[model samples]
Target: MKRTLHTVWLVARRELRTRVQTRAFVLGTLFMALLVLAFPVVTLFAGASNAPEDELSASDSTTRLGITQSANGLADPLERKAGVDRPAISVRKVADTETGKNLVREGELDGVVAGTPTAPELFVERHVFPHLERALTTITYNNQLDAEMSRSGLDPEAVRDRAGRGEVAIVSMGESQGAADGPMAGISDAEKAQRLIIAMISTFLLYMFLIMTGQMISQGVVEEKSSRVVEVLLSTIRSTELMAGKIVGIGLTGLIQFAVIGVLGFTAATATAVLTLPTFTVAGLLGWAVLWFLLGFTLYATMLAAASSLVSRQEDLQSVITPVIMLLIVPFFVGVSVLPTNPDGTTGTVLSMIPGFSPMLMPMRLALGGVPLWQGALSVVLSLVASAAVLWLGGRIYSNAVLRTGARVRLKDALRAS
Candidate 1:
């Protein structure tokens, strides 16, 4: 057992050194790191660009209007009708129509009102703002109605009082009743949005890492077999040892790259203020992501290595590995498409617990927050179990078929081989 472990460790060390020294690995790592760093900087700039406009809008909350003498009575009614929800209205008397138009054009006032209180002409730089327009329309209509009621010998004050009291009491049912104490409890809308972004980004990175590492393992296996490198290595080390070493080494390499990227992303996002989640929360998400990557890489790498052993050449590698690729792809698309809008939906919740799907889906749900502890625990347990089984079966197939060469070995023949 000691000798076997020593051999595996030697082979693993060799594989890791070879992979890390490659130009592709170095360049790919650097490129992905740069991209991760760039995302937060870009988001920060994008938000900063619009900051002034938003601040200006918030600071200037009052709508100033110049009203002519004929419409003087509207000053009080306009302010009153503007309502508590809308911006405050500040009305000032204007000398005449030309004067009011000049003030509006000069930007000293938001708008101008002329004619009598019942029949007002509004002037502005362009179109009237919605709140001010609504207020003017309501006040003018009420004035006309009051005049009509006076003619009919009805009390306008009583009618106005009754109408004012006829407001509809709003009852919002948009939020679930138990949301305050449920999975999403204590998270604000802004935080939820940030979490969604983080989840999406995490999902994408996991998917890419899995695809890249899976291909690397399959390609490495096929390349070694095709060049008879495995044959030479088998003379010194057992086939199972060689396969285990490759998976372990390549898995470690992938993990390093994954960690580098994750740390860069977390640092950049927090430094730029793009992510406002508690430090512990973000770190926890990163920790879970790393865990899932390890489990996912192990499960997929073993199968891919086994699948690649069925073929002797790189040309045949794609056909054998395409199914595994699809496994990764389908779960990826499903997670990204379904989780963002419905993080706690039945589909995401259930799929996140499935072995093949969990590696991709579970992390996303976790990142989005509110995932149950049992669900996460179950998914990890299932993945570990599935990976062990795949390792056993895949090791058998690889050991059986990796020794054979020439035309592609059939799956049955590989499994049935002595």
Candidate 2:
């Protein structure tokens, strides 16, 4: 056991050292950190841009309404007489009716209230803009109210306050405001959904790390085979020992890379005020991330190590690895496309329970919110069991196939050799 552990450690150290020394790894780390930082920055900008602009547009059939008088003076008189807070109406006297119509069409003027020798007639070139519509609605409603109050012999001040009363509160029984409020309440209605997204993103990221590192493991294995390094290494170490060492070494290397990225991302988020990291909360998101990350890395890395041993040639890697890569990718898209809608539904439950998919699915379920302690515990237990089985099976496959050269090894041949 001590020998196995020592061999694993040695292999892991070698793998870790190789990665840290590589230019690709350094560049990849920088790229990923930049991307992580970019996400929140982009989100902040998008949120700011989506805010409503305070601009108004109004129009009538043809004539334009020019408050030929001072806007402030008109607003006060209109407020006193009609009990309406009319917005500042500026006048633009054009050459003729056509020019006035042109200005209205160009959206330079709001509604043109044409003062004929008779009564006033309003004209708009087209449909109203939202801000203009709202402002118009308010002024019109107040004007009508003032007219009604004048008929009823009520003061305009008394009428305006009564008209602007707050709306009635209607509380429903057995309904959560969080769930019922529209998409805006997604944080509350779909806290679980948010959590699921985070979990899936994290899991997929870890899965990707394993895949990249696994490829490195495979390349390392192939390099040794091609260079006749294995022949010398085998003289000192058994095949199983060598395979074990490679797996442990490569996994540790992957974890170190993961740790660097994770730390950078976490620090970036906290420093940028994206996420608030707490001191001592047992179920805090950061704590969950740390726990789930370790579990996810361990589970995926074992399978990747095993997958590497299935082919000796670099050219054969795509064929041998396609299925395993698909296994990692399918759940990722599924989690993103399907899980949010049905957090506790069929997809979530099935994927979370499945041995190969549990690492991705379980965390997603938790993030979408409301994974019971027992369910999480069961998931962890299942993942551990699955990891053990894959490791055993994969190790056997590695032991049987690592020395083989030329063509890719079939699963049947791998199993038969085992």
Candidate 3:
């Protein structure tokens, strides 16, 4: 066991060294760093430049603060008080229906409030965004202070006092399924939002890495085969060992690249205040990323090694790899689609169970607070078993055909040799 591990490590280190030294790896990593950094900078600029105007525009600012006329006079001083220091709020006594409609269309008033002893009725043409709409609602409610008084069964002044004193306890049973004990059960809205952002980022990275790294492995193999290097290497090392070394080496290279990109991205996000330092615990993300990365590479690497054996030339590489590429690509789209609709849906559960898809699906499930301990354990076990099978079977094919040249190797020949 130790010897095998040492061999894997030696091969992995050699591969890692070769990959990092390559011009393509350096350029690709630099590009990723710039790309990730650019996003936060762009977002910060957009947010800063697009600050809400100091004054709501005349067309948009015109809002009607409604009042009810009692037999004696206007109900309360609430309308005037609510609009204090706010020039945009215009109090309008809606004595007639026609006057209200006309004012709204002319943009002379943004909305209408039918004031009663109860809470006023706000009639806006459309659902306004929350901030402005909130201001309107508060002003209207104060103008007709009847409902709050009735609900509290207290004097108007007492009702207002209690309303002011009452604290808002917003409890969100997260996962959107109303399930208790979710990861978000005790978390605040801000933390929940942060978790959501992180989950999205994690999913995107998982998908991106799988696509990019898998292709890199396939393409690297094709290049080596086309250049006739595999023929020379075959004499020194067994085909299986050669393929294993390449995959391990390439996977290590990809992991290193991924780590660099992640660190750069986190630094950029922190500097921009896009992600708070507390929100970006490296240990947590690295733990998850490393686990998923291995699972993903192990699941796909053997296929890549085997597929490369089918093609002897660069041009034929695409055709041989097309099926495996399609398989890998399909999960990304399927996982993405399933993530939103049912984060823990039947489809997600099934996908999580499949060794080939467990890497992507399990991380998503963990993020969404859907994975159970037993299920997670099962997924790991299944993935290991599948990876072992793939490595053994794929190595057989690779060993038989990697030495062949001039034409693509047939599946029958590979199987027969095996």
Per-prediction TM-score to the true structure, in the order listed: 0.70, 0.63, 0.65
By lDDT, the best candidate is: 1
Residue 200's lDDT in candidate 3: 65
Using TM-score as the yardstick, the better of models 1 and 2 is 1
Model 1: residues >4 Å from true position, as ranges?
51-183
- lDDT tens digits, residues 1-418, model 1? 9998998899889889999999999999999999999999898778768554223234577888999999999999887766543468888999999999998888899889999989999898866366677777878898899999999999999988988897643221112233223336546566688888988898899999999989889989999989998888988888999999899899888999999999999999987777756666777788888899999999999999999999998988889999989989999999889989988899989999888899999989888877656677888999999999999999999999998999888889888887
lDDT-superior candidate, 2 or 3: 3
| Candidate 2 per-residue C-alpha lDDT over 1-418 given as tens digits, one digit per residue, 9 for 90 to 100 | 8987787677667877887788998888888878877865665456346532212311122222444221222233332332112233444544555555667678676555444312234566555433234434455566566667788999999766877695543321112333323232223322333444455656666667756876776677777776667778777777777776776676666666676766666566545433322212113444455555566656665566566666776777677667777777776777667776777787678777676677667666655555556677777788788878877887787767767776777767877874
* lDDT (tens digit, per residue) of candidate 3 on 281-356: 4335545666888888877878877887778777888888788777777777777778655767788888977877
Candidate 3 Cα outliers beyond 4 Å, as residue runs: 1-11, 47-183, 277-282
lDDT of 1 at 273: 71
- For model 2 the TM-score comes to 0.63
> Where is the poorest 10-residue window by lDDT in model 3?
172-181
